[model samples]
Target: MRTDVLHAVRLARLDLTLIGRNTTVLVNVLLLPLLMAWFLTESVGDVEIAGVDGRLFVLTGMPGLIPGFAVFVNLVNSFTARREELVLKRLRGGQPSAAAVLGGSALGALALYLGQVALVAVWAGRSGGLVPANVPLLLLAAVLGVVLFCLLAAAFSGITPNAELAQVTVLPVLLVMLLGAPIAFPADTLPGVLGTVSHLLPATPLVEIMRTAFLGGDHVSGDGAALSMAGQWLTALPSFAVLLIWIAVAGVLARWLFRWEPRRG
Candidate 1:
């Protein structure tokens, strides 16, 4: 047990070092999302939405966006690169279980994503008066976002033939996840059936959870109703269920589709 943990930790450290050395990955996974958040926050400056500051609303969406790029898009490329290089195959041949191997490879990305989230949270708190109403719920949403996106990345990588193809493959998922969620605007304003369907997207629940945690209300119930902290926690239950379901679905797909070696030409 201890050996497995140690192996996973070592793999995570190595992956983090590699991520630091890769300029493109660092830029895409770390810099781009933060910049996007900053830009959006500034654009929405001092505006109010459903009684919550617009900047806070934008900041709450970072958990959704950060993991999408940091873990999902980045790991798809990471897994593809490692597979083509036979790194994944070599690791699989060793004592670490498949879960440990994949989890360790993904841990670094999760750490980076969390760091970006922290930066956004601190910035929002200081500048936008975004004090989270339910800190635990906020953390839960972030954790769930990381796990689901990591699994989705692993599953998606199975269909990605090469590192170059990863850039193209990630776009559709990003579009669906980001656009389908309440990022740039509130989900309740998305119009009729589209609004209803948006709630089903994997990113939606995570963002909803964060909004409830930070704003004490959600885009769905947009009448400026400030939920008590306990009420906010209760409101997050449905989103929690949605995230858990997606996590299970992603886990199944990853187990069935993830490839340790590159496909034969």
Candidate 2:
């Protein structure tokens, strides 16, 4: 047990070092999200959406976007690259357990994701007057978002043929996770069928959970009636359940489909 933890930590450190050396990956994983949040916040200005400040609305969505890119997109590329290089195969034959190998590879990305979330939270609090109405719920959403996206990344990596193909394969899931959520508009504002589909997207629950945590139930409930923080948490249960279901599905897919070696023609 202790050995697994140590191995995972060592692997995480190595991954972090590799990320630091790669300027493009570092920028995309760490800097791009901050810039996006800044630009989106600026564009929205002080307008209100669903009775919540637009800047706050955009800021709250960072939990969804950061993890989507840093964990899901980045991990698909990482896993695919390693598989193609035979690194995954070698590791599978070595001392590190599968859990340690996968968890360690994901830890570095998770760390970066968390750091970006903190930076956004601090910026939002100081500049956008975004105060958390429920800190526990906020933390829960962030953790679940990271775990769910990590599993999704692992599952998707199995389908990606190479690092280059990861870029193309990640787009559909990325678009759905980002645009399908209430990032640019309120959840209730999405049109008919689009609204129903958006609610089912993986990132939607995470965004909804964050928005509810930072704003309140009325902001997400769309009824114009304010809900107690407890009520807001209650309303978020469905979103939480959605995340759990995705996690389970992704876990099963990843276990079944993940390849340690590159595919042969």
Candidate 3:
């Protein structure tokens, strides 16, 4: 047990070092998201919807946007790079379990994602946007977002043929989360059909749940009023359920299709 833990830690450290040394990856993983959040919030400055402040809405959505990109998009590329280079195969021959090896490699990206979550909380709290009315719920939503997307990254990474193709393959899901989800625009701003489609994506519920924690309210109506459709505990249930269903399906696909080695050309 001790040995396994140590091995995982070492692998995590190795990932951290390698990731840290790469300036472009660091910018994309960390700086780009921060810039995106800053631009959107500034552009949409000091508005409100359904009695929930628009600034708060934007802040609440950051966890979904920032971490989704970092964990899912960034790690997909990282995992594919490692696999194409035979790093995963080599690691499998040694002490760490497959889970440990992947977990360790992911530690850096995970930390970055969690750090962004904390940044969102702190920035919102300090800026007087919204402090989470339910801190635990906020944290749960954030953590779940990271986990779901991380699982997705793993699943997608394995099937990606090489580092270059990872960029292309990651686009569909990334687009879903970025453009379709509430990250770029509010759920209410989207047309009904588009909103429903966005709701089906994993990011939609997580953002809604996080917003619920901050706003301390349920569904926001089109006219900027908070509706009573869901109470505190039940606020994010529908979205959560959708995410869970996706998670289950993605997990199955990942398990079935995930490859430790590059496919033969």
Candidate 4:
């Protein structure tokens, strides 16, 4: 790595440490989700995910989701906040590439994601019932998903003008995922057009990837639906490929159009 890249990495580590101190990030990353899961377990008490009657599936889904959400929320918020603060301006003036700055910010969130993963694993193991499956694919899908969303968030932030608008800027993407019910329902059962559209969202494939890994036979993925619902097995691959395409296109757009300047300029 270049000296600048190394410096950026160091900066990212420091920031991540500071984030551990920041209550806002701490609450969002750790407290809220844990509380949600505890309450969910109390309310539902041994509910199922796609027929998997175990806490393992629930834990797997929860941990698998953290990175995607963290990448989406953290990278964009941090990037835009720094941009509005002229941190990007100072760094660029000192010769750091946009890539370095972005990577630096992402490193912190990635670290947090990994930490969350470990905690979730411990929690799930202690909870008993169900077991995590296809560990390799689960890990791969998570890393890829994080990479994809971090860039998407940055791309969204690149076009945003100020901190106040960061949440608004991210709202559309969040709302689409929300509307599609990435967390609540199976995407396979969505209306045709809606399902097709969900195919384009970053979280869609990641969730399916998880469903396939953890839920296994119980998994009702769009990929699987293409085979049974439409009698075409090949549709799954293409649909999955679209996510990679989104990653590429969004990454390039983020690199090309992400701005560091205040909008009033």
Candidate 5:
């Protein structure tokens, strides 16, 4: 058990080093999200949904965006690049267990994930009026979202033919979560059917969790009408269950589909 932890840590360090040296990956993982957040802030400026200011809404949903770009995109690209370079294939012949290898590979992104969370939290607190009403639930949602997205990233990487094509394949999922879900837009503003479908997305529940945490159920119409769709669904546990289901599904798919060797052209 101790050996496994050590191996995973060592591999995680190596992965972090590689990420530091790779400017493109580093920027995409760290900078892109910040840019997106900034853009959202600029564009949405002061528009309120229900009663929540647009910037605060953006801050609340930033956690969901972090995982997609930081964990999903980074890991999919990392795993596919390693496979193409035969790094994962070579590691298999060595002493490290698969769990350690994969876990280690994910450690860097996890760090970035946490960093993004902290960044959002601090920024929201000072700049956007975020005060968590349920810290435990907020943390749970953030942590689970990171883990779920990382697993999904690995699963997607398994089927990705090469690193170059990863960008194309990854965009759809990212777009759906970022644009189609509540991450980029307020859930109440979406059409009923669109909002319902968006709620089914992985990022939606996490965003809902954060929204509830920050707004403390205050983001409603001043006259006590027009509550957010997320606020309405906050009473249900289905969102958490859906996230768990997706994690399990991703794990199974990754186990079955993840390749140690590169696919033939």
Candidate 6:
């Protein structure tokens, strides 16, 4: 919050340049959405999932996916790697508080997410796609999702011994998205257990947020009206809360757990 602290975060974020970072950012922001949308736009063409036309189901699944890719790929990995390298350690030991280091990383990720969203919206609109029904809610979901993932990513990095393993730390989250969630199939077609499980995952609400936005519906993906409302709030609030908690927990853990110079053992 202080001027000096803000300056430090800015400096730290600026130093996060890597070759694969560029490629990962590009693919997440550009190619993933296009490929998903294209799959939706095209016919199912004999494809069938959960007894429904595969393409239709996949289309319904695409909106939610935007959030998942945004979090795990766009924010989570980079934040963790930054922390794993003791970037946070160095910053905290210096003039910057832990907050500043995390804040700067968050701002960087948000900038990327917004930029990518803008590009997607512009290109999709010019191509005749529909805008989301509720812009405010969708944006809220996107931002909240980023905030949660950022802290969780940073916290998880504490368990990582080196920067190279940050990818492994974040890998399971990505795997969950690819496996049981909407990204895997149309919401309607997922079996009872998978549907139930997907609804429970952290990424579920994020995908639901995008799905509701694009499909022009509420994030109420269930039978109970109250339940749907609860689900929506559950996804957003907890997703955001867990991350801040993780930040606190991780900040403390890093005091002991994080090693600046690699251990020889």
**Per-residue alpha-carbon lDDT of model 1 for 186-244, expressed as tens digits?**
67787999998887888888887877776677544555477787788777788899999
Error of 1 at 196 (Å): 2.4
Clashing pairs in 2: none
* Candidate 6 per-residue lDDT over residues 1-265, each given as its tens digit: 5776666567546734542367766676457766766765574555764433444435544545554555445544555555556665676788766566666766666665665566656544555464545566568766766666665555555566665676677678777766766654544456888767776666666666654554453334422122243444453454345434544664565455544333345
- Give model 1 RMSD, 1 decimal: 1.6
Off by over 4 Å in 2: 216-219, 223-229
lDDT of 5 by residue, 1-265 (tens): 7877788889878878888899998899888888888888778887875567778777777776678888899999989999899999998778888888887866666777877877888888899666655666667777788778878888899889999999998999988887776764656567888867876788777776666655666321111133344553454256678788878888898888888899987
Question: Any runs in candidate 5 off by more than 4 Å, and if so which?
Answer: 218-236
lDDT of model number 1: 0.82
Ranking by TM-score: 1, 2, 3, 5, 4, 6
Per-residue lDDT for 47-150 in model 2, tens only? 98776677887888777777878888778889999999999999889989899898897777778777777787788789867667788988888878887887
- In candidate 6, how many clashes are counted? 1
Error of 5 at 112 (Å): 0.9
lDDT of 5: 0.76
**Residue 111, candidate 4: how far off, in angstroms?**
1.3
Per-candidate local distance difference test = 0.82, 0.81, 0.74, 0.64, 0.76, 0.56
lDDT at residue 4 of model 6 (Cα atoms) = 60
Please say which candidate is ahead in lDDT: 1 or 6: 1
**Residues 1-265 of candidate 3: C-alpha lDDT, one tens digit per residue:** 7777788788777877876899988888888888888888887877775565667668777776776677887888888988889988998887788878766755666677777777888888888755667777777776677767777888988788899998898888877777887764557677779877877778877877777776677642223234343465575677677768877877887787778898788
RMSD of each: 1.6, 1.8, 2.8, 4.5, 3.6, 5.5
True-vs-predicted CA distance for residue 132, candidate 2, Å: 2.5
Give the higher-lDDT candidate: 2 or 6. Answer: 2
Give the range where candidate 6 is weakest over 10 consecutive residues by summed lDDT.
218-227
> TM-scores of all models?
0.94, 0.93, 0.88, 0.80, 0.88, 0.68
lDDT of 6 at 115: 58
* Candidate number of the best lDDT: 1
Q: In model 4, what are the clashing residue pairs, if there are any?
A: none
Candidate 3's C-alpha runs over 4 A off are 1-6, 184-189, 219-230
